[model samples]
Structures are given as structure tokens and as C-alpha cells.
Target: MRSGKSKRVSGTGSGSRKGSGRGRRPGKTAGTSHHAAYNAGVAEGTSLNQSGGGRLSGHEAKLQMNERWTRRCMAKGASAGTAGKRIQESRAFAAGFAAALGQPDSAWQPVQLTRSAAAVVFAGPDANPASIRQLLRLPLEEIIVVQEGASEAQFAELKALPEIKILNPGEPLGADVWRAVGARVTRADIVLFADAAQLIEAEKLAQLLGAVQAGADVALVSYASRLGPFREWDDLMRVRAFVNWTLGRKELGVSSIGLLPHVWARSAMDAVGVKMLAVPPLAHVTAIQQRLRVQACPIAKRTANESGKSYQGLPPQASRKLTNESLQTVFGDHIEALRAAMKLKGARLAMPDNSRCRSAAGGAE
Candidate 1:
């Protein structure tokens, strides 16, 4: 019973397994700062080392290699942990990956320009200083924090930073509308939008930015894990799935621009118009119809700490009363999106439109 071998578990899309029951909110489980810096450095070093051997950009190429390696190890029955350890060892062959890991963040300062990006975060009721600190660490040229009835001391840290720009509108801008506001303010090639109140991580945000850099027009944090089994999903989940499915993107599952921290390419925003960003569902649908590259990027090391929290798993207990207004707003937006899609692709959405002889009933043709 003592074989000196490891068992690997390949995860092309981690936390998406049908009955796995690990529906954690995405973004919180990002590796710590030191780990993040090291991984980023390794990714960058690998990209540099490749020197354009294949069609894939360094990021995509490295991602593919990792998936392949994981799959190979799993085929031979290696544990996920073992595969991970081995992968860390194998990355040495990626040329400078080993050296990059050893180097400090200061050592790689010269090449940080490539990560230039921007963010629009709404500090809702859940705002906190820690989350704001995380946002500042990204390579964003500016972080536009929209304060929703927050006090002066509420976002002191945001104002303290030279890169932070606080926007205080006399009247409230609806939930996702701030995305449009931020998009209008920034000239960055890549932009991120999120509710600053969320307990998200800087490294995860950076990953979304990196995806745009690697050529995805819209990079969504995979939220499939948050939506338990398909059979037990609620109307919200159904709507999300239907939206992606109706647009010939069933593979995206329940990922939507309406939820989670998502990033977009400036070109994609330009194509759809910044105003479209106000209605996230509509913007997402329009982008897909226009053939823009959208991806539901799988989050690595996702944390399930929010297990008892509402909406990420089993139905909220009786104590957690559903907010009717929020529900109506989201559903209304979904209707508007579907209506817009119907206008472009007929009411049936990608399904065949039968050519009927209406003239048979009337006296035309």
C-alpha cells in the first residue's frame, strides 16, 4: 500500500463540477500579495522566455501548458496538490520563471507599464478600507470610487492616494451605471468595474486585467461555483444561463456582466458605446451578438468562506429577507436585454424562423 506516486486532479474550470457543492463567491481566494507577485512574475518571465514560438500570446500559451500538464499528471493519477508542486518545479524550464520568482516586486518595476489599467468601484453599504487598499495595489492608472452616501472619513485612503479619484454625484447613479461613468472618465486600454463593497482580492482583479491584455474583450470571473446544481438554480441563475445560451454562448453558463468583478477592453466599450455599460446585461448581450471575444475565466484558489452568506449556495434562510427592489431591477434589466436581442435576432432568439405563407390566409403574393 505504499507506492511513491502522486494523483493529479485536472481543473480546466475549477469549482464548476455539477455536484461538487463548493459554490464560493469568486475573487476572495486570490493568493496573498507575496504569492501573487511571485505568480505574476513567473507568468511574465514565461511569456518573455517563449519568444513567440506559437500563435498564442505568452499568457494564453502558458495557461494552455498549465492545463495540459495538469491533465497529463491527472491521467497518471497524481493528486492536485502533487500536480501543483510538480508544476511549480517544472516552470523552471520556462526560462526566467525560476529567477522571476526569486526576484522582488521592486526588481520588476521597469516592466510594469504593460499592466496599465483603470477601475470603477462603487462603495456601497459594504465598503471597507481593506478592500480599497487591495484595489490600489493594481497597476491601474486611476481608481474612480463612487461614494454612495458615504461619510468624509469613509474613503480617506482612496483620497489619500494620488491615483484615486473620488466621484460624488448629488443624485444616486443606479448600481451598474457607475460603470458608464468610469468608462467615460478613463482612457485606459483595460478597465475594471466592481462594487468596492465586495471582499475581493487584488490578485484576482489583476488576473481579469491580464486577461484583457491577453486579447479577451471581456474577462469575467467564473461564478458557476456560486450557482449550485443547475437543477436547483433560481430564476436569477436561469436568466443568466438563458442569456448566454440564447446568444450561442452556452459554454459561459451563468457568468454575466451584471454580477462579479469584470474587466473590459476599451475597444469593446467603444464598439458598444460607453452608455451601454449602464445596463450590464444589455451590454453583455450586445457584445456577444457583435462577435466580441468574451470569456468566463476560471478563478484559481477560490475560497468558500462565504458559505453561510446569502445567494452563493442553498436558498437563503427565512431570516434573510429578499430585497424586492433589487430583484425587480435585475429582472427588469434582463427583460430589456432580451427585448433588445429580440429586435436584432427575432423574438425566438437564435432559433430558426420558419418562412410561412401568410398570403395563403390573405390575398398577397
Candidate 2:
């Protein structure tokens, strides 16, 4: 069922025409005083333009430009929303089909392995490794921490954990981290690309593994933001996420955003290529997620605060830009590619209910 939100109107319409001289012939008898006054007003400064026949004034032109921009933004937003809805519907159909096929929910069994899953933690210079160590109590087979501008001492401190590997990039952190996570790690069934400050739940690792066993390629974990009460940043993030999830599912035939603390299969990670992350993390992840049938698994609440500190030494503006780029990469032309691939493969694409996915799959308690 479609959500009750009103369908947004596309912003496309003709601009207002300037006053016409043909309407007022030179020899025409001006009938009424009101008409004369109107003409006078047009001749005076009230009207946009008088000398150029039907040209608009600078202010009028500016107004038109603003209107056009406004319309474009609205149209873009509407288009995104429509795409998202389509994905949701497709998922629903797929889920119903699966149910009808009598596909047992617990048919797939989890891999019985004694080794712990490897988690790749991408941390900033200022992240408190202590907090991360305390939060994530998973029996990690290997913990690879990628830090930028961190001292050897700090790296050593983080590597105090058993079976931990610390890599400090003297220069800017690049695809090396992604490559390590994608290629280097051998025993890793699940890879958790996370920040140091992000507090992952104790059971998050197990839950992620469960989802993977259930046939999910990528699984995203949900957490609450513990930053300020509510801000524009939060709203924008929500909108971005909603749009990403909707469009990714519908147009790209993949699941995109929901929450952080993401977990994914090692095989799928290798397939998408590590270089993809360096280009656009979100988009790359989305492409891989769709390609691999990414799923979501609810976990602990995520708290983001000023104390959490920044990563990659990137300014706030740069971070935002990176995120936007990632979104564009995932949903841009990639969606069309995914659709084409789906058609070629004769894959049955379904749109599941976003509400149900959000609730049951992952996000919040």
C-alpha cells in the first residue's frame, strides 16, 4: 500500500508573459478612465518593462529565474519520491511471491565456524578507541583500524587488543583501507565498516551473521543519533536516507540507506571492487547492495555527538559533499544499469513495504 503522503507536483510550467503592445494600439480610442490609468501605470515604473515592447525588467527576470529554480528542485524531489515508491511496491510483490513459493524463512543455515568475523574500523585522528573497544565485544578474528594523521603511539594503543592490526596512513586515507577490508581479510565472513565512536551493540555481530545466513549480501544496523536534540542536519540526513532507500529499491533494484553500523558478506565485497568505495562510498555500497541483495538487521541505538569526533581529517562541508556524491553515484545512472541488468537476467524485482522493512528488517527497536 502506498503511503498517505501527498504526491508532489512536478515543477514545469510556462513563464509569465510580459505586457504586450499589440493589446494597446496607438490609434485605439481609450474607453475608460480605469484603462487610461492602467496604461499610465504600465508606462510608469509599476510595470516590468515599457520601452522594449514586451521585455521584462531586471527584477522580473530575477523573479522568473528564482521560479524556474524552485520548479526544478520540486520536480527533482518529486521524481525521487516517485522512484522510491515504485521500489517499495516492487519489494512487496517479491516478498509475496517468495511467500507463495513456500520458501521457508529458516531454510538457509548459518555457517558453523569457530573463527571470529573481521571488522574494519575507519577512525579519525580524534576517535576514542577505548570507547570502541568497550562497545564492541565481539570475538573479532581481526580488527583493522584505518587512521589518518595518527601517531605511532596512538596506533599502538589502539592495537593493544589481541589480533588487532593498525594501519596509519602518513598521507590522506584513501582506498587502502577499503582494499584491506575487501582483499586482505581471509577469515572474515562479515565486514563492519564503522567509525570509532560508533557504539555497536554486543549482539550486532551475531545478528548480522544471521542475516547473511538468511541470504542477505549486505546488512545495515540501526542506531540512534545521540547528538543535539534536533537540527537541520538531522532532517536532511533523514530525507537523504528516505530518498536513497526508496530510489535504490525501486530504480536500482537494491537497498541503500536505513542506518549505519553496516555488515556485509566478504564475497559480495570482493565482487563490487574496493575502488568503488574510494569513488563514492554510499553509491558504491548501494550498487553492491543491490547487486548482492543487501538486507537490514536491527541492532543497538547509534549515538553521534561532538565528542564522537571527526574522521579522515575532512571538514564538515567536505564530508557532506562526499555523502551527496555517494548518493548521486548510487542512484544516478547506476539505477538504470541495475534495471537493465535485472531485465537481462530476467530477475524478479519486488518492492516491499518501507514501513515493514524499516520496522522488521532494521531501524530502531
Candidate 3:
């Protein structure tokens, strides 16, 4: 989802400038030889495919579809043993061809460019002034803070800051609406959305901005720990990640583990309507549907001690339930698309190796 626009110049009256975890660090350098690099890239792609890092390639995808069909055949009374043999044969053929051909180098390469970025923080009641001040030090052109139903007293502190734009939206526009409003007013080449208390270090911002410059439509921050209290990633997050890669929207195989302090290219945001809720599942779904290049970069995870009052506002239990419900509401209509795309990976998306092993054992007569 890389765009071909010149870097946006910084707006007037900025005080100064500045320079710019966890999930498996992106694969090391792909070595010198084109063949070797290509193979390495393919291996990374395969790893990503299995791990749900991105989408499966065509040959692999066909094989996945065939496997699903074979499962259906077994479900309808075909011999399980024969169906299993066909699955193995297809995989063998796929392995031989994939090893020889490898994936395109462009698939692994990160889009690179130099551009200015803007940070849009959704300032809730528990917004952290210190975190906001820290974020301001990054080499961004502007900062826009969205607060729903903010009073004059609430506006006083944020408005006092130079180069900051405060959007009250007058009425409470709920989570996604106000964020969308704030993004509409953001005028930088790259737009980042983080919570008021989310701690996004300067180093992380540089990596994210680099991805956007490199032509990624959206650059996400993937933390080392599980994003929420859920035992697994939310169902919609998993489905979106799979669909994005399976449909070939993004090449750099970053996991859609979580979206926080995420950065987006203005064009990409506009391409897929910007919905800036406290949580933006729909924003990601639209990006995938539009085939935008979405990459996930890893950052050191934030700790409970670090989160403080922000976590307290929406207590973990309520937060978890609401998050699940919101994502469900956002994605309910798109379940069929999710189901079809998920078949490319199947239960692999839901089960870890151990669970698969246990289930396999339990199935034995």
C-alpha cells in the first residue's frame, strides 16, 4: 500500500526537531546472492504463512484450498486415509516447486522513504500529560489530540501547548467517530494513533515511520506480550491478519498481533475509511479489504506497573468483554469473508502445536 507522494514539509512555528521489541525480530539480512536471498525470503514467507504472520502465497494457497476440500471430502464419507494421502502428495509437490522457484524478492523487501509524520493521540479522561509531552519530543510535524465532550478546563492544559490541535467534536462521538474526526484534521504524510497513556518510545516511532516511508500503507506496533487478557489474539484480529496476507494486500509478513500507537499513511487511511475508535478493528478490516500494505513491527511490551491509571479507567474485566463485543459487532457482517479466508490456514489459526497434538491424540480410536 505504498504511495508515490513527496514528503510533506513541516508546518511553520515548531520549536525544534528530533531524531527517531519482542515479537521475533524480523529475519536477519537475506545475505548477498539473489538466489540465496530469494530462498531466505521464501523461507521467511513460509514461516510467516504457518505463524499467521501474513498471507499464504498462490501455490501454497491452492494447496491450502485443496486440503480444505479434502477435509470436506472426508467429512462426507471419503476414506480418511486416502484423503490424507492426497493432501500429503499435494504438499510434496508444493514443497518441491516452492523450493525451486521461491517467492518474489519484492514480497520481503520493506518499502523505504523519508517523510514527516503526525501523532494523533485519543485523549480520554485518563489521558497522561507526561506521556503526551514525551511523545511531542519525537521528530513529528504536529500533534492532534481528540477529546470527546472536553470542557474548557479540559482544553486549557492541551491548548496551552504550541503546535497542538485539540478537536472536541462538540458532542461525544463515541470511540471510532471522534478519532476519525481528528484524523480528518491531521495533515501529515503519516498519521499515528496512540492512547494518551500508551508509551511509544522515540525508537519505536522511527521504525514505524521507516515502514511508511518504505511504502507500507500502515505500520503497526506489535508488542511482545498478549495485547489484552485474552488467551489468544481476538478472533477478528486473527482473521484480519490472515485475510490481509491470504488476499495479498501486504507482503512484509508482520503479524496483526495488536494495533496500538500505530502509524498510517494519509493515503492509506483515506483509501480505507479512517475509523478511530478507542480500538480500531474496523479500520484494519477495511485496510485488508482494500489490499493496503500493512506491516507489524515489534516493540518491547508495556508493563502493568507502567500503565497505571489508564488501565484502571476501563477495568481489565470490562475492557476485555467490551473489546470482544466491539470487534464482534464490527466484524459480524463480514464473517463469511473471514471464514473463506480462514480456510487458508484453518484451525492452525486457533490451535498451537500442543493443542493440535492433544486433539490428534484424542481423535485416535
Candidate 4:
């Protein structure tokens, strides 16, 4: 009886030890282990970029490391899920660091367009079916269509296109919201952004891609516009240009780079915090503030009047609010101060004449 009891006790003890060891292995490896490495990478990258003023270069370095980390993990027989989680943690770190620095993720390395390339087409409810078809036909590895407000027919048409992936946010989240969504969903070297109404051609996409390949952090489509019937639209550009001038970027003016048919490095957008809104003006402001290399590729000649279908392609109130917001963001708090100062100066300069002094001097009193 004593011998049988001892055997049972020993067996139970051994099983408990084995189970405890198994649980500790995963806890140490998956939680504490990877976390330490990820934090180290973030701290090192953030410090290096901040010190050297090499934000863009630092971004490229982090991206390369992420790719390598994923590859090594996969080669070592790690599951795809494990590899992806590690990569995502590193990416999230980089993104947060970039935002804290008030800059876009600028890449010093030439973009590798072949392996990681995609497009995000932000289509409105009135998107033409033919245009959607044209966009899908582009020679892109992956295409994501974010439909803001679509009819059942529109959803059906988009769904039928096997080459494209569709995202319906159920309601209109604004252009910037959709743009950011597109950026997040795509893991491409260069992410092409376009509006459904923009009538972007395959060749145009190639041109934008070419600009990105040549080291432009973001490439925009530029066209000339004159002040006339579309006074409001012209005023928007004027405000943008004025803000740029105030920033001492006198040679730069607001352009269509944010309008659509634009391409940006994925790393750059990711670092910029992929926000709920990223208008063309805001995009320009961010790239400029980050000191990113921005290139403008001129489009085929066309009247500015022929460019937009609706007035500025936005509802009147939305147009006003977004325009104001973009201008305020670009100019900063100093703009309000400047306006107040001007008002004070004007009041002083236009002070009412001293009527009593005039009467006394003329001996009228």
C-alpha cells in the first residue's frame, strides 16, 4: 500500500511540472519576449530619427527591419499569424513615433513597387460604372474600392468585379476618412489614391507611380486654374497659396495633388497616423511640414472649369468647413493672432480725427 501511494504522488507531481513549464514557455516567448524587442526597436528608431533629423531615413530603416523580421520568423517555421503580429507591432510603434515627431514617414530608399503595390479608389454614390470598371482594369496587384454611399446596384456591380475588393462604410465618412481607410487596408510599397469621378487612366497611375519610384514621398496631379465663375473654388486655392506664402514656401502653391490621381509611399502615410481625414490641402501641408520630397506631375491641358462636376465636388457647407479647417491647420494658431494684431493696427491707424483740436487751432472756439 505504501509503494502504490508513492507512485501515484510522483506521477501527479511530474504531470503538474510539465504542464507548468508548457504554460510558462508561451508566456515568456509570445508576451514578454517579443514586447522587449519591439520596444527596443521603437526607442532606437525614434531616437535616431529625432537626433539626426533623418525622419524619412529612419522610416525606411524600420520598414526594412520589419520585412526582415517577418521573413526570419517565417523561415524559422513561425506561423503566418505569428509573423504578421510581430510585423504589425513594429509598424504600430513606428507610426506612433512618427506622429509624435510631427512628420510624415519619409523613405530614403527607392520604393519596391513590384512585390507591394496596390490602389485604393474612393468612390462616391454617383460613381459611374464604366469608371469603376476602368479602375479595376488597371494593372495593379490589388485594388480596394471604398464606396462612401452606394445603391444596391452599385454594390452588386463592384462585387461582380473579382479583381477588386469593396468596402462600404454604410454611411459617408467624408473623403479624408475613406482615404485613410484605404491607406490602412493596403500594404503596398506605393498606394495609388483616386476618386471615382476623377477619370484616372492607367497611364496616369503609372506616372504617379513613376514619381514615387523616383523618391517623391507623395506625388500629386497639377493643373492651372484661373479666378472666374468658380470664385469659391479659386478662393480655396488662394487661401492655400497664401498660407504657403506665409510659411515662406513662396514658390509653392496649392495644387491638385490632393484632389485625386495621387500616389504616396505606404510608409509615409502609415507614419502620418492614417487619420479619419486627409484632404489634398492637408496632405500638402503634412508633406511640406515633414520636409518630404513632393513632386507635381502636370496633367494634360484642360480648363479648370471642366475639372470638377459639382461645385468643388463637395456640398456647399462641407466645402466651406473643410476649406476653413485645412487653412487653419496649415497656418496654425498664429493665424488668429495675426488677424487680431491687424485689427488692432487698423483701429489705431483709422482713429477718429481730433475734432476739438482742430476747432481750437482754427480759433473757432
Highest-scoring model, lDDT: 1
What does candidate 3's lDDT look like per residue over 97-180, in tens digits?
A: 233233221111111223556777777665666656655434455577887555567668767664566777666675456557
Residue 216, candidate 1: Cα error in Å is: 0.5
Write model 4 residue lDDT over 271-291, tens digit each, in one string.
555671355455555555566
Task: Mark the regions of model 3 whose C-alpha exceeds 4 Å error after superposition.
Answer: 1-113, 149-153, 224-258, 275-279, 300-365
User: Which wins on lDDT, candidate 2 or candidate 3?
Assistant: 3
Model 1 spans with C-alpha error above 4 angstroms: 1-115, 302-322, 353-365
Clashes per candidate, residues 3 or more apart or on different chains: 6, 15, 11, 3
What residue runs in model 4 are displaced by over 4 Å at the alpha carbon? Answer: 1-115, 225-233, 276-280, 300-365
Check candidate 1 and list the clashing pairs. Answer: 6-78, 7-77, 7-78, 7-79, 8-78, 8-79
Highest TM-score, which number?
Answer: 1
Query: What is the overall TM-score of model 4 with all chains considered together?
Result: 0.50
Q: List per-prediction Cα lDDT, in the order shown.
A: 0.57, 0.40, 0.48, 0.48
Against the correct fold, how does model 2 do in TM-score? 0.44
Worst 10 residues of 1 by lDDT: 103-112
